[model samples]
Structure formats: C-alpha cells, structure tokens
Target: ALHLEMTGFLVVKPEGYVEEAAAGEEGTVYAEADYKTQVATNVQTQEVIDSVVVYITGRNYQDFPEVVALVEDATDQLTFAEDAKAKAEAAAGTGDWQNATLWAGQWWQYQVKAADIGLRAKTFLDEHGAVETAQ
Candidate 1:
C-alpha cells in the first residue's frame, strides 16, 4: 500500500473474525484490524479491504472542481482590476477627473470582488477537507 501522507483524515475502523485460509491464498489475503499480520482467504474479507482502499483513495484524494472555479473567477477579477487601473491612469493623463474617478471606483470594485471570490474559495476548500487543517 502507498503511504497515505495524511492519517488524520482517513480513519479506519476494522471489526472482523478469524477464518480458515483458502488454497493458494494461504498468505495474508485480507486483515482489516491487523492488516500487517493476520491472513485472510475469504471473498467477503477481500471485499472489505477493497472498500477501505477505495474509500481512502477516492473523492477525498482530489480537490473539488467548484473550488478551482472560484479561484479562476478570482483571477479573472484581478485581471479586470488591472485593466481598470490602466483606464484610470489614461483618464487622469487626459485631465478628465470625473472619468478617472469613475475608473478608480471600477478598479476598487474589481479588487473587492477578487478578494471575496478568493476568500470564498479558500473557505469552501477548508470546509470540504481538501485543504488539511493544521494539527
């Protein structure tokens, strides 16, 4: 088995009984509680191990797509903020104070949106367990 870096996240509970080993699978076939020592040669036991493996390595292993989308939204908003800043600079260069102020307001709005989106994404990831909490 590959080393699971985060043991805190994946908690396994094993409740089982000893069974006779089948032919050929005399070695440890499946042992939930004492996986390193006990040998199992039963289909039911193998299924349990398979389920545990899948549970540990399935959805919890990857980032949520919505979280990634939120980050992309934040990045796009930041890009717009930069563009707004450029427009504000150009308006100021032409001595259009009103237009410059309007552009500056737009830039601020974009910045706020970006910040909100980024924060929301982080919160979502933290709540979903994709981002590990500090021990």
Candidate 2:
C-alpha cells in the first residue's frame, strides 16, 4: 500500500540591503544583512504550509565574520533524513517489512525529522549571529 501526499519545498534568497529615510540624512546607508525564506507544501491539497526564514542583519552581520560558516554549519546538521533513507533502503533489500519497520519508518519520520533539524539549525545560526527577522 502506498500512502500519498502532496509535497514541495522552497528556498528564499536574502535581499542584500534595506532602505530607510534618516531624520536629517540626504541618503540611506547600507543596512548590511542577508536573508532567506523557506516553505513547503502538499502538492495535491495546495494548502498553506508552515515555514521558516533565516536572516542575518544589522549589527549582527558586523559581529559575525563568517556568515557562510554559519549557513554551512546549519546545513551540515540536517542529514537525518538522508541517513534514514539509506538505512531504509538497506533494510528493504531483504524484501521484508517486519524487520524493516525501524528503517521503513523513514517515510513517516521525514517531516518531523526535517522540522526538528530546521529548528535546531536555526537556533545554532541565531546563536552565532543569524537573526530570524520573519517567517
């Protein structure tokens, strides 16, 4: 039996600068920040989905010397699903589900695992100077 659901994912790129009008200044100074947004959805239903955005801005950007390092760290921590998939495939090699439930659980575990990973990654990023400006 196949349990089907609509699914999709998105990655948002950050805008480089923000514009503001100073009280007495003639022009705007560079805000100096980066941002990204991500979203996921069920393809069949087309319903609104929960999502997260990671951003680095303001004085925080100045404090963090390696912004990309933070991003890479976050990405590195999110391989749980990939690992789960590999384990599932290996277990299915014997053509059995009884002993494979642990590995086969990957399908159900994906979303939860991914979400947890995202949250943790976001936390790590924030601690290192990445800000969550919006969802």
Candidate 3:
C-alpha cells in the first residue's frame, strides 16, 4: 500500500494504484484514488477473471467552501454508485456468479468522480488563522 500525507490531507492506496494530474490554479492540488480490485471470478477456473476499477479524485485550493462543495458533489455521486453496487451484490444471491458479476458490473466504470481529500482542512485553517487575523 501507498500512504501520503500533507498538512491537512492524507491518502492510502494499495500497491499498483495509479495517480493522474492535470494543470490547474497555482494552489490547487489534485489526487485520484483507484479502487479497482478483483470483484468476482469464474468458479471453475478458480482464477481471478474479472475485476473492476473506478477513480475518485479530490481537488482543493487552500480552504475554500466553494471548492469543498464541488468535491462533495462528486463524492456524493461516488457514494451513490458504491451503494448501488452493494445492493446489486445482495440481490444477486449466493452461487449466482453470472448474475452477481452482471449486476455489479453495471455500476462499475473507469470514470473519475469527485471525492473529499481532507477532513481537517478547516481545523487546520482555524488553528492558523491567527497569522492572517493578526496581519
């Protein structure tokens, strides 16, 4: 697994995960988390024949609520897709590999979505606000 940390952000991903970046404003940072792993396999082959992958990206610039709102919207969509996948698996029932894979694959995509990268950015800014306020 890979781990990353900054003043107010943290990310962890298993080995082999990929990261992509695009040009943006000076202070803006972007990171994409790949959550693709073996989701199902062929019973007879006993080999990992099927896998799924999707990218969840988080972007931020300093500590702005507008930026947070954009990230939140993307995260919301990612969560919706994840929940639908779970429900599909449950409804597919056991020993039904074909149906399970089919239903789950319906929600899996190689697309990138917005995600939350920091849970403590606001706190960090609050703690450091003294410098700004004092100036």
Candidate 4:
C-alpha cells in the first residue's frame, strides 16, 4: 500500500501596467494575470509540498507596432533589472557603500517597471493587441 500526504504551500500575486506615448498620444491597451506552481516530494515519507504564484500585468499602446516594441523593450528592461540587482548585491558584499547604494537605487527603480512589464506581456498575448486613446 502507498499513501500520499500534503505538506506545505505558498502563493504570490503581482500586478502592473504599461503606458506608451507617440506623437503626443498615449494610452493603455492590455492587461493580464499569470499563475505558476511549484511542488516537492519526499519519496520515503510520501509527503508532497506545493506552491503557487500569480502575476497581473497591463499596457497601453498608441498602435500595434508600438505594442510590439513595448513588449521587446520590457523584456530587455527585465534582464537589465536582474543584472542590476546582482551587481548591487555584489557591491554590498564588497563594502562599497556608495556604489552599493547607487546600484540598490537602480534595482529599486527597475521595480517600478513591473506594471509596464505586465502590460507588454498582456498585449503580446492578445489577438488584436493594440489599443489607442485620445490625448
């Protein structure tokens, strides 16, 4: 006979938006939510653990091309943020307070893009992914 037991779980919810401007026009066009899960197992004990994460994102676009560009830019920004965070951590460890603080500020500034990131992601998922607003 075999038995399975539940152990532990966690969840994360994130929300954000993207805005675009072109020719003095600006708008928000898309929004989205993402869900993720993680699991762990103990073979002998037959115990399982699971975790979930959810993120919400949105964006505004002046045109379809702008939306596409925004998506690409947002992806690049995310990569930059990751690198900046790592550099900041390294600076802190090295006792370079000034550089550490600057990097840390950069890391935090990158966090502001969460909304823009979400918006671009959502726009990419949509079939007619662009929305325009009168300015």
Candidate 5:
C-alpha cells in the first residue's frame, strides 16, 4: 500500500552549524537547506518513493521566528493541486523521467491531502506499487 508520512517542517543546518549557532560564533554565513515536509513510501517494502520538501537560505542564527514564517509560507505555496498536476504532466510529456518522477511524487502528495479531506484521490504508482530495481 501507499504510505504517506507527514514529516512536517524540519529545519536542518549544515554539519557543525548548530553548534556554531549555539556558540554564537562570528563570521557565520547562511546557505540553503532542504527540509522534508512529507514523504511517501511503500509500506510492504519500506522503500521511500517520494517526498515533499522545501529549501530556504538564512543569515541570522537566532531568527527562528522569521525562519518559521518562511517555512510556513513556502509550505503553503506547495498546496496547489492543479499546479502540481500541470508540472507532473509537463515533465512526463517531455520524457523527463527524473523530473517526471519528482513532480509525480508531488502530485501524489496533493492527492493524498485531498483524500484526507474526504475527497477522492488517485495513486501514483502502478498496481505493484513502487519497486526498487538495480540500474
């Protein structure tokens, strides 16, 4: 079965960045980090298939409130089902398997969200679900 795991908002700093931020070290710079908000997996096989994530760059180490707001804003922007569908379809149409898989995973997320609200949703994987094959 398709398993959707809601990871929610997670802010991951670079290696040692957390300690540096805690120590209030000077000359600290900011870079972007991808936060996984949600993930999809095959329950029977325990294989990760897709995920919803967001990236944000920041400068201030103590500005968690602002960062929280930014995360919320970015997460809100990803809830468009139509946009996800369009992107997924467009990618698939162009035979961009990589992007197609990414967007399709995103589209599946919207579908799962829809299902949670009592709306009908479709599955993204085939009848066998997601299977890992050696490349």
Candidate 6:
C-alpha cells in the first residue's frame, strides 16, 4: 500500500540556482524539475494483508485540524493501551499470574479504549472523505 502511494508521493518546492552568464550579461537558465504529491500511510500487519495505509483524506484541504485533534486523542489512548498490553504480556510470560491478572484487567480496558478510538476514526473518515482527485 505504501509502495503504491509512494509512487505518487511528491515534495515540490522552488529550488536550484541560476548561474550568471558573462558576469550578469544574462543569467543562465538552470535546470528545473517538479513532482506531484501522493500520500499513503499505514502500519504493516503480520496477517494475510502485508501492507496497509490508514489515513483520512480531507475535502479540498490538507490542513485538517479536526483530523489532527482526533489523531492526537487516539494516539494518546493507543500509547496507553500498548504499554498496558506490554506489561501484561511480560507478567504473564514470566509466570506471574497474580500480577498478570491485575495488569491483564487494565490491558483489557485499554484494548477496548483503543478499539473505540479506531471506530471513531473510521466513522469520521467515512463521513468526511475527501473528493478523490488524480494528480
């Protein structure tokens, strides 16, 4: 997924220098090039699908404040969830069922939170998907 998106990804900006010809008699026209932008973002999965891109495109706009906020909130929740899951896994792996139970309980709650966040993001993106454009 990232590979396909990357093919279209682009970073266009004014660059390159114009060389002086004959001491300012005429500025040499330097070479110039430009490219388009394509964005695909995703985290790899071990399951059947090897790649994926998780992002919500905005309608005729790139600076999506609402999307940013949503992402921030979700990220925070996911971070906590990841940490909890790691702790619980470590405890269980070490045969510490006593603490594992406690941490596992917290891990379960965080897992729910993360799932909810995922749902919220999906819903928002689906409702506000950008008008698809070819570059």
TM-score of each: 0.49, 0.31, 0.33, 0.38, 0.30, 0.46
User: Model 6: how far is 54 from its true place, Å?
Assistant: 2.4
Write model 2 residue lDDT over 113-135, tens digit each, in one string.
44454455445566775543432
Top of the candidates by lDDT: 1
The model with the greater lDDT, 3 or 4, is 4
Runs in model 4 lying further than 4 Å from the true structure: 1-66, 120-135
- Which candidate should be chosen as best, given TM-score against the real structure? 1
Global CA lDDT computed for model 5: 0.39
Model 4 global lDDT (CA atoms, 0 to 1): 0.44
Instruction: Give a tens-digit lDDT track for model 4, residues 37-59.
Output: 00011111112101100111222
**Cα RMSD (Å) between model 2 and the true structure?**
26.5
Ranking by TM-score: 1, 6, 4, 3, 2, 5
* TM-score of candidate 3 against the unseen true structure: 0.33
Cα lDDT for residue 102, model 1?
Answer: 65
The lDDT values for all models are 0.56, 0.41, 0.39, 0.44, 0.39, 0.47
For model 3, the superposed segments whose C-alpha errors exceed 4 Å read 1-62, 114-135
The pairs that clash in candidate 3 are none
After superposition on all CA atoms, what RMSD does each candidate show versus the true structure?
Answer: 30.0, 26.5, 22.3, 25.2, 22.8, 23.8
lDDT of 2 at 41: 22
Task: Please give the range of 10 consecutive residues that has the lowest summed lDDT in model 1.
Answer: 33-42
Candidate 3 RMSD computed on C-alpha atoms after optimal superposition onto the true structure: 22.3
